[model samples]
Target chain A: MSLQPLACIIPPDLLAAVAREADATQRQALLDTLQLDQSFRVVRAENAARTVETTRALTPRVGAGTPSRSIYDQKHSTATTPGTLARSEGQAPVADVSVNQAYDNFGYTYKLYWDIFHRDSIDDQGLPIEGLVHFGANYDNAFWDGAGHMFFGDGDGQMLTDTTKGIDVVGHELTHGVTQHEANLTYSGQSGALNESVSDVFGSLVKQYHLGQDVATADWLIGADIVGPQLAPALRSMKAPGTANHYDNQPATMDGYVHTTSDNGGVHTNSGIPNHAFYVIATTIGGNAWEAAGQIWYDTLVDPRLRPNATFSKFAALTLRSARTRYGASSNEAAAVKTGWDEVKVRVR
Target chain B: MNLPGSTGDPSGLPDPAHPRDMSDAGLHVTYRRSGGIAGLDLVAECAGSDLPQDHARVARDLLDAPADEPGRGGTEREAAVVPAGADRFTYTVHITDGTRHRTLTWSEGAVPSAAEPLLASLGGLATPQRAP
Candidate 1:
């Protein structure tokens, strides 16, 4: 809920994907802007530090639903923020789904921490859930800066909706902080991709639990709500990784056509392989996603063995090892874990 | 966000053997289908569109294409409900922030009748000079 305290280290690809196919010069300009944005992020962090010094507010809370209390919504663009005068403690917004969606997403994510994980908000220090719904000029995607905050982009409306439409997205973005706090996975190549996959795994589990949807009903896709109706429906699909989204001029394969450009070495696209792996593991386990499958992935995410830029194969091995370690070597969960990885074309020793 | 069917490229071909009307490569229509439905990959050559992209336009339209939709067949889910070739269809908006290229597809239809108002609230895509 406070200002940015950490780095806004998004691999250039996310920004690249945001600016796919831009001309060479324009692309470079955008990249420069991104770098500038990062520097600006530093400035924002300094500001947050100043605010903390002035207010000394450690616990983030909501006053009125309309006027979002989280620092994330300051200077927000949508009517969703409602822009209330200030936090009015316990006041609900009557204007839009934006406020309610923020309220619910924050509540669900907070509960996941407090109950399931026994942690607090994104920071694990009861950090306020700074949520900015409808971010950017109809942008798509949600992000959690190292600084204790979250922002959601309203989809262009064809494939995606508001990035905040899904609880898992919020959880996924917030968990990015968790990953940074724990593994600090470098934002590119295999490790960065693994970092992204971990967030997807945890994010999906959060959605599954909140919706009470069993693995059977849950659709395994990231940013399911962000895509426009005309384009691909899935930003990423798990059951069929490459099957997510393919349209006119968009290549669906991962090896070559998938994004492997500069920014963080395509963490988002490479993550598909692992996301598919997790889907298989949960399906093979034949129960709730948060059960053994969730436990195994969660353990690996926090395991000291996980290293930055660890390739998909390495992480797969780690999951296999973690599952065996967490739930006895002979456990069905472990077998399912192995099978899941195998199905994803990941073979372990 | 009504997952309209009219949004995606309408000429997605399942059978390449069938020669498509290949006058324009850019306007070749494609469609996002439903999960249970089988897709048709038609060899569609686009025709009709002839516009060149500028630096600013490319940057804005780069990510203009829609992100992947959920529940399968991309934009086809929304297309299924609309009358064939209905005005309610999928459209692609290529935007360039003068830096990165983004393609966004515009699809409108049956997101969930309840979502009509919300979709409108999200607003339409920015108009830009299309790439020739």
Candidate 2:
């Protein structure tokens, strides 16, 4: 079966709380909103399945009126495929800015792996990408499924505009598939949380490289553009998770933590810890995340010793070792990892 | 040697748990009675073992008596949980202790899920139940 983003990742409460509105007018509005979302999921899924994968579908096949920045919607049930459920450059392909952004983001992703990693595709085996954009027309949020594709939902004018409004989010979803293949990290508890963190690290790095933004200039805010005015929080904040979102939720740092099943073992929330760790590491070294920080993290992921259910401590140790192994015992790469861990208060011990 | 016989429904299926046993993960039935069976024999060939100890001693004397032993003519059985993966099936055959009159069962490799109910047919086994 194709990948299905779990019900847990995006809590039903957002929709439920809206549905419970006492005002009759508000309730009807919420129902209409939710109905639109469900419909998009169905359509997006049909698209992902129709094509072998997203990148391949894009390759050599310029669709009729393909949005310069088009959004797709993949309707999936769980994590299982080469997933890319949806895409959108901006507002809509008709909207010049949106289309241009979407096309550029999509193109950059294809280019990044082909040039730097020399990976033919997501799977390094010519695996296809499946993306769904403008999901629900105004639904909020975007996610990558083990289903092997991604799905992007437009924000409700208040929370988020469109998932593809940003390139980092796109990279974030694709990176989930990468993490799945390399570590197959169990999607629960701490391991699951790390899975999310890894996605953010790579996702942000992709954007950094594309924009030529350095460690200091990068906003380090994941999904800042994705969130709309009405929403309190963006999808997640790597710099300071809880702070970015409107909710008084704790920061993604380990010291200010929330342990619950709210976000798939807090994959979205807790990912902040390791994300911040990488940010600190990249910022400390003063360059691209893909260089030292991304390489060490990526190398650790493919390490044979990595298990399906590894926590932050376990992952930190692995990165430390990988930095030393790749750059040498006392190289700056290794020291940056040490400092990175120190900043996160997760001792290299 | 071919061990006298090899014909059966599941003669060479891989064991789900740990294979590498004389019984081929409980699929092969060998004559290992005190009558001096020199080597392992298949269930069908078990009739004329080097020991020639007789089927009753090898089948009944070794395993627990069928709950319906005596007049009822019933067969004994045991069940175990599936290990690790979702697809494979296995069984833990019980051994009967002559002195304590106790039954001890051990887990064996992938057994056909279909073989469960048929195990009851071992009863009235005027013939040997070969490695199926």
Candidate 3:
């Protein structure tokens, strides 16, 4: 079936806060973003219903191929849909920092999935990657439309900088597309939180894999490079949830799980629980995160048992099963997986 | 966003849970807009004696709008599966006039065309901008 088209890096609550709290000048932009987001949601949903379904079979593209990337420029206007083409794969570097960053970071994201997971492009079919930069006037978010496109905004200088600056942010958005092609997790409650957490996990993995950083060395911060000077030091910290400067609502364990009815059931906030689990596993495994820890998560993401409406406990159980299957049940990898979930208070049984 | 998972029955009967009758017992209306980019809540109230006359008058005018009709004109079929970070807003207009309590919910990025006037009147009252 066709996947839903609803993904944005910056949570709705954050944008809502800016809209409600920002000065008149800033409030208008955030308001416009909200409108823009609704418009896109409608478009994606319609497109998905009509678009052809692609099965997740890990099959390579027809002509044994390479990465295909295209970058566009919106010129600070939301009127045009994908904007003007700025850069493409195998092309020379462009003058715009956002364009180059999107191109380069997207390349790394593609590399992480290809080299590490041995998966093809987004669709495992050499699907072309596209990005639109400077999407709106001081737009403070980035997103991947389920239709295979990444849109980055020049953040409002006060709360956020250029979204393209964050590699993990791009990775996070792309991984949403990955989840779409795979489990197609429902976008609400725990399933929605799992969808969000999956993106964060792979997003960090993309950064780690690109930088050659091991789990111990990785910062474990999702949007460290994108947050503006005035806001939090980072969006959310996997290693330490509430440590991020201004955005301190995230709870590292189940005890702190938020039960609000916003942010699609607090998908962004509750994601910290699973994020910490992944961090614990990777650090305890003590090596490149992509090796064992990341692999286990990846396997779980692509596993058939991962249903559309998976809960944290269900997902944790799947990871344990994947770990045991990949490594022996008594292997340290399996025990580390259990320990990771246990620390997060997600009973795997 | 108001009545999440409320199944559409196709029949014309109103949902029993959503009692449409406004209680003449006393008007108490509360408007809560949740789901901005930050997912912060904006709450505004117009109750028996607590609200100032000026705000109460505004609330009276807002309640004059049809309570039964959805604020946004059309239902977005795509919203059923919208993922987190979609950056849209969800608004809950809670009306409690004495024994009669009714809540109407709508979600979107832009203010509903019909509810703009109501939201505009309440925006300043509920979501006061930080004093810069």
Enumerate the candidates' DockQ scores in order.
0.04, 0.00, 0.05
Cα shift from native, residue A109, model 2 (Å)? 2.1
Ranking by DockQ: 3, 1, 2
Candidate 2 stretches with Cα past 4 Å from truth are A1-103, A248-252, B1-132
> What is the C-alpha lDDT profile of model 3 across A1-349, one tens digit per residue?
6755345466667889878988999899888888888666655654554343335334565643467899999898754368789998899998999999999998999999988877787777777888889876676667666677777878766556898989998888888888988898887778877888898999999999999999878999878888777555887889997676564577899999888665567777788899999999999999999999998999899888999899999999999988877775667998999999999999996
lDDT of 3 at A150: 73
The lDDT of each candidate is 0.52, 0.52, 0.71
Model 1 regions lying over 4 Å from their true place: A1-90, A248-259, B1-132
* Per-residue lDDT of model 1, residues A1-349, tens digit only: 6766235566656877765678888888777867777777655654553343211134434431122235234344533333433222246653556656766766776665555555555545555556666555544445554565566656557445766667777778777777877677776556766776787788777877888878999987665655566445655566766565563221222343244322223455566667777888899888788877876776677667887657777788888877766665667888988887766666675
- Alpha-carbon shift of residue A343 in model 3 (angstroms): 0.4
Give per-residue CA lDDT, model 2, range A1-349, as digits (tens). 7766333244446876868964888888767767767666655654553343335324533232222333333332222232342344344344434434555666676556555554454555555665655433343445554556555555446545766667887777777777777787765557866776776777777788888888878878776667666443454566765566544243445686556422333444456678788877887777776777877887788776789888788899999888766676667888888887777777565
Better by DockQ, candidate 3 or 2: 3
Candidate 2 DockQ vs. native: 0.00
User: lDDT (0-100) at residue A115 of candidate 1?
Assistant: 55
Model 3 lDDT, full chain set: 0.71
Better of 2 and 3 by TM-score: 3
Q: Which candidate is the best by lDDT?
A: 3
Ranking by lDDT: 3, 1, 2
